[model samples]
Target: MEDEHKELYIKEKFNNIDYMMLKSITDCIYEAVCVIDEYGIVIVWNKSAEKLYNIAYEKIIGQNIEDFFDDAMVNNVRKTGVSIENKCHCPLKNHPVLANSMPLYIRNVFRGAVSTDRDFEELSRLYSELENANSKLIFLENQVKKNLGIFGNIIGKSSSIVKKIDMARQIAPTNSSVMITGESGTGKEVFAKGIHELSGRKGLFVPVNCSAIPSELFESEFFGYCSGAFTGANRKGKIGIFELANEGTVFLDEIGDMPLSMQAKLLRVLQEREIIRVGGEKSIKLNLRVISATNKSLQEMVKTNKFREDLYYRLNVVEINLPPLRDRKEDIPLFIDHFIKEFSEKNSKNIIKIHGEVMNILNQYKWPGNIRELMNVIEHIVVTNKNGIIQKNSIPEYILLHMKENEFFKEYPLDLTRAIRELEIENIKKALKITKNNKSKAAKLLNIPRGTLYHKIDEYKIKKL
Candidate 1:
């Protein structure tokens, strides 16, 4: 009799709760919640459910959920008296969701089932938004490329490069001889090409390597030989580099390597604005621009009598020097981006993002070979990258090892004594921070005496944060 009274009391208290209370509670949830009777008729539907399925409560309350959704989990749960959790389901033909359904039982008898569903379209919407953003970014980048004009191929925007570009543009229209001086792989040839493009010359740009030419053949090569004048010469008499470059630009690379004997002849040709073919008396008039590049200092070579002083002045009438990659760390990222895009398209890769840590490591490196080495490294990374993202591990092993070897003095100068001092000061500050500015604990952490730590702190001028 007491047990019966307890059951009656429990049933009475639950019966007091009504549909309005359940509606209020379920409507507050963000997910779609629906309840169905054991007969498969929809008994309750929250506002979220209505929005998710585009169905109203009045329309669905008495209707069978199976009529609307052939694969409704609630119907299965109601019939089987089992629960389904975290299953992907498609109720409407096109609408998909992740749903959970559980059987409801009272007094040891199955009554109904309830299911809650989270929308899958939300994630799809977010992915669409990201793709749109990427498209816009690519468009803006293309516009920036278009605005760069002929200088677009010459990538760096650092103050050193920008100033040089401006100077090149200003000197391009003039016919004065130009001498380009820089270390090898500093992009001297590309800069020369940019100048030639800006010069608006009608004739083709001719490139001659002074170091590659044989001393014996230099005269015949510069001044085309008459037919039958030299053995193995073209029968019709080949056009020389200068004659081929008439009304255009002549790029003389490694000009310091020109033999001293040929230097005087070249100076005479430049001075007289004419050249006589080998074994031919008639002089051919010339009209062209001279641009010479050399890794060696022509001044030093002139002082040593290796290079003619007159030829040096003729070539060095206007000089432009390119800075190496190590001096312009600010431009490394720009080069990395440009090279990655170039090599990715060439190799049919869709490389989209670079890992932040990879950028940091690349920026910290000192490129001994300048832009050329950096471009090669980026090509290797992109070609070997299996995923769309460029990770730190994708970097070449040599660069990673070099970075690790130099990790200790990354922020300090290469001077050993000064680097040691800077490292010591940095550690002292870290110890202080860890100890909450307590000198005793800080010294103990650093394995030094408290008095010594205090003296070192004062000496290094470290203060509490």
Candidate 2:
């Protein structure tokens, strides 16, 4: 047996022609590939193999395969004349790897084996990051249960969210102004607060909703007024948001809504880094980071002469345009899970899992109101569902009406009436299966009128099984 094994290894020794051909083949392959004779001696070691294992080809080519790689694949292939592919190693390194080994036979005689390696380093990094983000999300959910005021966590791993999060993190250390643009309820305030927390700012994060402040009081609200400056003013006078937020950050929400007069004053404060009280003359030098957000487009407003172009450019030193929830549907499951757990704990309930139909509808909905709307819907379901499961009926009537109007199969071949009829049949069967064939329960879960449901059941010939 030993002699036969030695014969097989020695008989396959590379001839001059074989050596050049093997070298050329190995040199062209991008993956790390190594060949071992039946007797377990390395026959061919490519450049990629040298770099992958940090070994010199000179030292490895004539050495025994056991001197380096101890995997079972080569030996198994040599013995069984079989091949293995894409075997993932446990406890992977910085460069996670997938390996393939195949038996090499010459003239129907088992001689040696060749193995290839594929690098998974980039994939490993991405998966590692996603795991970290998910862990942090769970931690945030727990902490949110403890208190609702602390909101620093930006919980998502979608490409869209990750890009914005990376941008926020990168710009946090710098003092440049950031203009966050997105539709309403898209978590603009959350992102602003997150930036402040990451910025190492000692002062508070003061948020001013420009639209909420009355135009007449905009000056006093932004730049404090002296005592007795006007009737009904605070006796000792009060500092404005900018001055109060000195050494920290002033997040001006809805920057586009600031009146033209206030826009000029705000621009000066941004340029001069100072603010004068409404009635006093002395200028208070401000050391603050201004991070502003708006649902409206300042660029278009500038074209219309409603917003100052210079101020727009000033605030937009670094722009972060947050994608709407509909754009990153991949993050919906994460957000839904977070909100459900959060609201469940908040309401002291065990409720979990939205109805399948409702979830499908939600995932399909274009969330015009964004995250805030999603949060509100989850809260309503948690509060209303004492039965522990949120049924389709738990959804607000308006949303249900919209879902009906959209009619999932509107683009199909059938007309609206036929499409709706088929949808009802499919849903009835699904609801029955989900409810374990309980007719009354399934009807209730489907949110259909009981009389109408019975008529459909008879019309469609739906059975419990």
> In the order shown, what is each candidate's alpha-carbon RMSD?
33.0, 28.0
Q: Distance (Å) between predicted and true CA of 304, model 1?
A: 1.1
For each candidate in turn, the TM-score is 0.56, 0.57
Best lDDT goes to which candidate? 1
Q: Put down candidate 2 lDDT per residue, 55-132, tens digits, no spaces.
A: 887776666777765654665677687898887642123445677889988678777898887666544446635643
Q: Name the top TM-score candidate.
A: 2
Count clashes in each candidate, considering only residues at least 3 apart in sequence or on different chains. 0, 0
Instruction: Evaluate model 1: give its TM-score.
Output: 0.56
Q: Compute the lDDT of residue 259 as modeled in candidate 1.
A: 90
For residues 53-110, write the lDDT of model 1, one tens digit per residue: 8998767766778888888888889889889998888877878898999997768777
Model 2: number of backbone collisions = 0
Clashing residue pairs, backbone N/CA/C < 3 A, model 2: none
